[model samples]
Target: MNLPELLYALALQHVPNLGDSTARKLIRHCGSAEAVFREKKQNLLKLNGIGKTRIANLQHTAHLKAAEEELKFIEKNGIGVAYFRDQDYPEKLKHCFDGPLLLFYRGNINLQKKKLISIVGTRNITGHGAAFCEELIAGLAPLDPVIVSGFAYGVDITAQRAAVKHGLQTVGCLAHGLNQIYPKAHRKYMAGIEENGGFFTDFWSTDKFDRNNFLKRNRIIAGLSEATIVIESAEKGGSLVTADLANSYNREVFAVPGRPGDIYSKGCNDLIKSQNAHVLTSAADLVYILNWELPSTERAVQKQLFVSLEPEEEIIAEYLQNMGKAELDLIALNCKYPTFKAASVLLNMELKGLIRPLPGKLFELV
Candidate 1:
């Protein structure tokens, strides 16, 4: 974007108490960020959710001055900015209701790859958790998925380092502004991370470093990926919050189950018991659930000759044969079965080699 337009957008973003969702609504209503400033207060209040308090600072000159200063910092630092409305914004994040209005990134990061997986866990990662995290990334290396995580001490660093070791691109979402790195010890790894994939953040250069910022940063980690995996977490942590955010965004969430009574495993077990996340034992589980490509031998579609199916399975098979592919809900509706029952029948059919599961909860005849 040009200087004038970007400045206006940044000013809109800087408006106090105005969030991304509300900002987007105003921008859409006004047609442009520049237009939002020029729009009359009476007109803006007409839109739902645009309360007096939210837009109270719309006319404040301080926001524009702050935007100009931020713009200068961005230019001087050679940072790349992705406007929410632009084509270059992360595609998956675009679907989120509360995604950032603008994303600032640095390094050789690329978003064209469709396979984005987020890995998050406790800062006090256990040995087993670290092993699983590394093994999972190593197993998934062949798919060339972009691994994403907060560049924190434990599980996050383990996953990102493994991704680098495996020659995969990895992105670090920062809770603070890109101008500074938290847990200063992590600074050493920044160069390697930027060499392949880089850092992403929405915080301005002047934003304060606060513990509360991590909660807001969690949303970006959850929003950027097709799935978020919790390697290990206590009963409560930022990683669990990220899992919840991913579920809220309708993205897949996976948790690695640990032994019973294990403090760190409690969170994962709870998530699975509540049916909020899928139990992830290995990378293969993620691959199958996401419908990523398998090895050629495993991917070969061999029809099971004279395959036998139960009555419900037969009904589903016929539906898929006619429809080519059908989602679980549709299969249940057309086959006169409850959704859970349909899922069970489909699982049997899959084991029988009569059908297969696909991404987006779709199923098809083998």
Candidate 2:
């Protein structure tokens, strides 16, 4: 959009309590943000869901002044802006009802035909959870998917770092404005992430930093991806909120299952029990469920590797290889392993890409 149009849109976005959905309605009805400002109050009131209270600040001079200042910041910092109606806006996010009217970002981030996966979890990440987050990214690296996260501590940072290590794009969604970085300790990662994938936010440079802002930003993280994965979450946390947002968007939500008694695992276990999220034991489960196409070269290379299997996993794989495809119980019986033990081994084999699970609890070599 032109500078004049952006100024008007930003001002409209600056109006207090004027939500994105409502803003979109106004823009659609008025033909443009500039037109919305010129529209008569009586005409705007005629639109459904528009009320005096909601548009009370619509004509405020301060909003336009703030927008002017923010525009200066955008110009000075070389920030990229994505208007909701524009082609450059994130395709997945545009479908969300409450998506940001204006999305500001910085870096060489590219989403064209890219596979977007979001990984979220507790800021106080456990060692096991961190390992799993990294391993999951490593496993999915061959497909060259773009990793999306909140850029917070724990699972978010772990996933992004793994993406960088694997030479994949990683976008960090920020809670605050682009003027500064939160958790100041992460300032070091700015250059590297910007060099590849960068940061995204709807907040302006002048917006106050508040805790509630973090909750609001969760929608962006959830909406920008094809699927959102929860590495580990407590019974109540932001990651759970993100999962809920993803579900609301009708996107796939996956949670890493933890032991029933573990504190961090309770949220994931409950999500699985309630059927709110798919059980994410391995990256293979995500790939299979999403039906993402794997590269022929990577599949060929994976089949050639035969290392890193435990004794039990090797036994299950051998049984499946010989039988072609055998029921879980039959494999357990033939391998002299307990049913539960055999199931665990099969999961490990799935993680290693050695075998795949079929219908009716059957197993077959991948």
Candidate 3:
């Protein structure tokens, strides 16, 4: 089997306490990943912070049979591996201090785009919010831009699925290595992503999923993409972390607004209200602000032939638009769902980020 540079990069990756930054430093001083492997323990420990413990731990490179097994698993699946020192590593992400030393990609999507955006939100979403997500995805659909996100739940899935449905490349940035899909439910879909062109992660199969690894994964999501989009975040967690990192990297941050009282919407509205994000009401809003150059095919398909909404959906959308705002109960009556079912639908829509909820279950069409 033909192995890539990252196969060896995984050697350094398997070493404890020897991160990308330190690895890069070692490579800069010593030259090449192979040299680091060939060096004696005393020589490795001579470098700054290359403590005795780190060197001793790294000597375990001799036990690469496990790493080899990990590589075999991914290779068996025909997945691709990328390393920072290789020409295929993303140019934009290479400069980041703690960027990944290697990535395991399974999809056919384009990591390089004139503009890339990340979409993420809560696992629990609203139908109203989902509608908004659909609209946003539909609006942005024509642009042919690469969409990047963690392959978790809610907004992330929505954005990736929508992008693929619209014939755009979507890259799923994974927290764990390509060894397995975390949620497991999305395996079939993730396989479809690989078929259509979305890549996976960098770690070896044996690198059991870890919490800190997820945090490290976020930087790559932010670094690889050109901008970040928060569809529906609660006031805390992963989506917020992505937004913060994107801003730190000076990438554009866009947030859809939510209602005053809706818990899910609070994060997005707050980000905009706090000036961490530019407010985006529609794809048009984003296109205009960014002066985006839309793909020709997408522009041709922009006109809505029929209202994509169902009869009751149109009524609810119209009702929300006319009332300027109404609580979930009032909207529920309009949509034929019991309050509970209606709420579920609304959460899905909210994840899509369609309408913002107000203080008393009130929702206003965005």
Give the per-residue lDDT of model 3 (tens digit) for 229-336.
888888887888889988888888888887889999899998998999987656655665677764544333432435265454566667777888887777777667
Please give each candidate's TM-score: 0.81, 0.86, 0.76
The full ranking of all candidates by lDDT, starting with the best, is 1, 2, 3
- Candidate 1 C-alpha lDDT tens digits along 306-363: 7666687778888999999998889878999745456656654665557788988898
What ranges in model 2 sit over 4 Å off? 296-366
Is candidate 2 or 3 superior in lDDT? 2
For model 2, the run of ten residues with the poorest summed lDDT: 297-306
Deviation (Å) of 161 in candidate 1: 0.3
> Which parts of model 3 have CA positions greater than 4 angstroms off?
1-7, 40-46, 61-63, 295-366
* CA lDDT of each prediction against the hidden true structure: 0.88, 0.88, 0.72
